[model samples]
Target: MSNVKLKNSTTELRDLDALHHLHPFTDHKSLRSGGARVIVKGDGPYVWDSEGHRILDGMAGLWTTNVGYGRSELADAARDQMLELPFYNTFFRTTHPPVVALSQKLAGITPAHINQVFYGSSGSESNDTAIRLIRHYWTLKGEPKRRIIISRKNAYHGSTIAAGSMGGMGHVHKHSYPVYEGFRHIMDPCWFDEGQDGESLEAFGLRAARALEDEILAVGPENVAAFAGEPVQGAGGVKIAPPSYWKEIQRIVDTYGILLLADEVITGFGRLGTWFASDYYGIKPNIITFAKAVTSGYLPLSGILVDDRIVAALMDHDDDFNHGYTFSGHPVACAVALKNIEIMERENLVARVADYGAPALAKLLARFEDHPLVGEVRSVGMMGAIELVADKRTRRRFDNPGRVGLICRDHFFREGFIMRAVFDTMVCAPPLIWGDGEFAEAERVIGRALDLTLADVAGEIAA
Candidate 1:
């Protein structure tokens, strides 16, 4: 660790935090009462808190940090780029070498049809760009009325007004000041929760996919602009789509001749054991929203991969697109992204996650299947989720959903592991760099936390 100013104690830092910091998605009253766990530093798949606890990060820093923490190579890349060209805009016909190279690199790895990228600073910004791009594309194609975009309930695209509107989460929408118009949502293809009694997983998935078709027809196919979805719903509890879902969605989009937008913010890079989850699912989307893992959370960089068709359409229009961010295609961020991809390629991190990390995690999590409190254990690539239920046979949830999940999440923290609780489902997306030993450690810690939570919840239920 570098020489830095030291605080008198963790309590001092917590006091400072409580005084000023308004954390995202946090309750001020709760934070003021309990204080916050201040993370001091990080290395590999672990982070040290202000109290000096070496906690294993099972959620991979909000589903980013796929390459893990404290990689000097990435830091060096940023430093070199900053020294050479710290900042430059991709607006007003200005161009930079780093952005140029990064664009080419992204094109090379993304789907064949996607050869163009529009950069932004975060996933929310990228989805906003996507909305404008899609709506403009339709306008250029002489379909100005085709503005409706369909999303799935519980899907999380981003938190911006435009992006959050694109997402289907009711909580975000409820609080969203002046929610944007022209968005419709259908049922999510989460078989574990929504599947009917005795309904096969494949059948349930197909039925869910049909919801998109139903919505499109209701809105009228000619009036719909595009359909947006995450390849795997990350914030929606790591909900993996059943085998038949993506294929049917692909058919629906193609049949309507409307655009298909894949929100790859969380599932992009190696999180899905492929360059992008669309490739894993064999679905060809017209636009792909990417962020988070592209730079492995080392730097803020997000973009939308526009299919060649859209690029061609824009070219034919010969009208100014007139949409961008101040830090679009930023040189230093682009340079760090290049270095991040290089490291992934050199280390074969994608292959490692596929052949080593994912299988190990799946095997370890599968043991919880027969546990009394566990209703289901599902995983894909390095991400997994364990759903907690009051009655396993009935898939009945606790009296108050998310209360038990919060309890389990607390246990994970106390036990030196970090897993996020989405309602009653405990989800994890550990770093791709984690190997057998890390997986084993995570399994052991998580198992112990679950046992403790089961007992705690049992007493609560009895009471």
Candidate 2:
């Protein structure tokens, strides 16, 4: 009965939200007509809406909640820090204990020879910092003309102008303000879509990676500063590069003396069963931009891990650095992150991902690899994707891309699951705390959603 009243209140609240609230990446007109789903609470891999429906969160709140939802440890840490010292800026030569401890913890966990930390509230901010630091580093080294940063197409860095320019999504750039200059975009190593009809994966990967060399020379190596990329492209349909891709990328960047910046915002903090994708792939980038899972979505926190070589250059230059945020190292956020890491360590979550979670997810998702509706199935660590298609042999897309994806996305919610659809590819990156049971449930629900979508698109599919 209480759920009934709560549902009514939810309707009223949704009405209020439609009148005033503006959501990101949403079609406001359509949202106002359909109304918003009010999520009232969450507990251990599940969230309850106002109508009392328990939905399994497969995306883990935008791929951040590694420790899962409703962990009291994180809440307690935030509360304790709030009581002790809620607000204190890291600027003005004043640093708090939580920030200091977190810095040490981050440096210890990150790759060797990378000891400096710069804090921000989100990945966008950290990427912005990367842009400035890269340009400034070149300036300090007396080569201010080395301003161009190369990234891959279909990459997602962040939404800020600087970060967006660094990204390769032209549609996102068209809708937002004008993109800033000094950024180059190369083709991504998407073997499924970009590979030739008879080409091998390894051959395609090498060709795709060589595009970086082509771009650097086009921009002139003397003017190039860095090459930025997500270890695995998350928003770009959970695309996984071939094994040969990164090695070739590292080689080209090294040959040109350009900085390699790994954007680990999605693959960081054990998402890939390792501390960072840099380690998983055996590449040591000069800088790593991280956020999202750093605090397990418990609090907003993000930062960059700068190599000691860059730190040395900055120290010798003797400038203010002139970058930071009001909440640069907010004590409360650092406290939550510290606790989140502790929980992950105490539970051995990283090893579990390597030993159990990833393997189970791969085995489950592999069941759909040959399904008519699925063009491809890819999984790495806890993240995976099922690409929907109109014709499997040619990898042909739907007449209207993202239409079938929206249909499947709605079906996921109706069937009590939350999996994101990027265009026609359904992506999943569930919380690391999820086990075999949760994995089975996800497989069942997603399988059913695929069946329903297949039926809906039967006539459109080419037999």
Candidate 3:
């Protein structure tokens, strides 16, 4: 794809893509010029392109394939449930078995205090529910002015109007559409990029975390309701916040009596070494939005786990809580989610991620620690990022981020790997099921790509 002019011999996929494909975050014309490489199927850690080339899913299907691809068990559970009950809208006080059972299982596994759950069909929808619920909850308590929800700059939440606004990804915001009112963007604890020289990581973390306090105070604490953030910033180039950041953030939110909403859409399940990134970071959020691995993405399922305090407030005051989706608690989706959790638990997959994921991934990272073109190798559990820079000393990005990253991405794709180029940062949140060998293979492939990228993008990187 360096100068994508490839031809599609069989026009089946390309024709469909050209006719009906309105891709998100893509240059449609460029994609049209480059015939679409339709990923027809996947098995375990690999997927086959339309041309039958096997590519290792380094990004794990946009960081969602926690249990890995071709897990027949998930398929089987979905199939069985679909046959029994395909679709039943969770409306008009109708209840279902899977929804009830799954909620119970989730509550049992998650921290005891964070027990109440609200269901939605997607991460975006779940976050939407969270924002509304958070605001409405505050309103119910007569604190109507506590409406502002704080989010970090460069954060990626979701694409819905509310969720996108809650997220701080600049490109995600639509000026014409204008973000909905009451969502404030704040600086992140991105140590590598923003930390000043001679500052200790811990010191930098505390300073960064205090920004939330500044925001709350600036906005007036009485007007701030919640602070929404990802445990490990996923799409904003896998920006790992400093160690003390979450603790400080929790302290600030607690001081202001504000809610902490953890958007663990990517870092939840087994991706973050623990069952949830909030648990891993020791930040007990008031509300946590989850998706992706809820059912290993087998069926569209997402949720928000609410803290006991919020639940108690709503229960004692509100008549019925006043909000829910038609598919709030779909039985089959919930059933599959329960099964996915069971599979993860029965195999100790979360423990495995903590024990083996980082160590195995460390080897790959070690190779880049001293590489000339590499700026940083940051990792937490299976979640990691390899940032490329022109001047490592100055932290200068390549002149043409799109071109340079695309070169690396193209080479890797052609050489049998699938990893996303987040600007010039290559991100990886592979499935927890990956073993030592898979890690090594990914490293080798990536190393080869880097070598070629450095050689190929010499002019672009230099410019």
Candidate 4:
């Protein structure tokens, strides 16, 4: 196509999007004014915008796409499945080969105790399923009153009503007014932000874990059904708890006999170098919610891996669970996920993250810790964060919480990379396929962005 035609197409697309597209978690007003960047294509770890900019996909397409982009094998899997069985509901006690095969694959890879799968089309749906499933399990055991599921503040589970209520972000909750009952939250283990002055990470971790116990006591243990959390708080600025955190959390949940729900939507399927973050953290959860990387975002698919104990409780009740989506166990999505996993295994992607990607990313991010505008640098597996601060010594934030972050994020885009900003914390989860070349480019692009952001926020730091 001619450059003139391409430019016209890009402009026309942007105009149409501004007119009709209502994006999730986006300010429509701002989006309309600024216009969204039109991503045209992706290959390996890079995406090309409509403007012909080749940028590193530092976020792995919202923490999915572990196998990177343009894998014809995944497309072929989808095409084959579509040709064979495009749409078949898993209702009426009916089953298909793709779903069954994927189910077995998931069960084999998940934690030992988790042997059953419940399907949905997104993380939000999966989490909503979890809420109902947890309550149902307790009710089956004759503890219907145990409905409250405790989570950490600022955590991002999903955007649906139930999932949003379960998450602790006040912004998300505001829109979900009269927020769903029986959901409570405690402080997240964001040591850099919430830790007491001079407190060690270990001590802060213990304190954070104890908060669950505190909330449980306040709510009455008998009334609490389970504790839910992401093993690594991905959307909450990649907040990784200290070493002591998950161990203590496990002990607390065990003590109270409440179920543990690990929301591994972002960290599952080798984002954290393990099949699930639960394994990485060494916590045995009763249920594990998974999505995103399961199919590398080739198609939307999400689900929960139920522990055998819960499955047994569910089985004891002879009636229907009365919960599921129309597209539950979608055959096409299942086929894509199966193929995605096959590629990951054949290429050893998970081990690649563990042995090289994680360490390399850590080193790359660490280089920015001494930047004038950076407060701290942290990473776990492929996930990473760089805290933008006005006062590094005092860990003080800019006046407007996300203002600096947005600025930095824009800088990253302009510098030929994509990085997400949670308030003043810039986070990235590059594809597992990223190697020395990607890391080298990231260092250059990210350093320039940071320097540019620092220049933009110099006045705030001075004040």
Query: Quick one: ranking by lDDT, best first?
Result: 4, 2, 1, 3
As a TM-score, model 1 comes out at 0.98
Runs of candidate 2 with Cα error greater than 4 angstroms are 1-8
Candidate lDDT scores, in order, read: 0.91, 0.92, 0.85, 0.93
Question: For candidate 3, lDDT tens digit of each residue in 97-189?
Answer: 888898888888677688878998888998999999899889888899999999999898899989999999877796428888899988888
State TM-scores per candidate. 0.98, 0.98, 0.95, 0.98
* Model 1 accuracy (lDDT, Cα): 0.91
Better of 1 and 3 by lDDT: 1
**Steric clashes per prediction:** 0, 0, 0, 0
Badly placed stretches (over 4 Å) of model 3 are 1-10, 460-463
TM-score of 2: 0.98
| Alpha-carbon lDDT of model 3 | 0.85
- The residue-by-residue lDDT of candidate 1 on 294-388, one tens digit each, is 89898899999999989999999767999988999999999999999999999999988888888888998998898888999999999999999
lDDT of 4 by residue, 1-463 (tens): 2454355777788887887789988998889988888888899999999889999999999999999999999999999999999999999999999999999999999888889999999999989999999999999999999999999998998999899999998999999977899899999998998899889999999999999999999989999999999999999899999999999999999999999999999999998898888999999999999999999999999999999999999788789999989999999999999999999999998899899999999999998888989899999999999999999899989997999999999999999999999999999999999989999999999889999998887888844
lDDT of 3 at 261: 93
- What residue pairs clash in candidate 1, if any at all? none
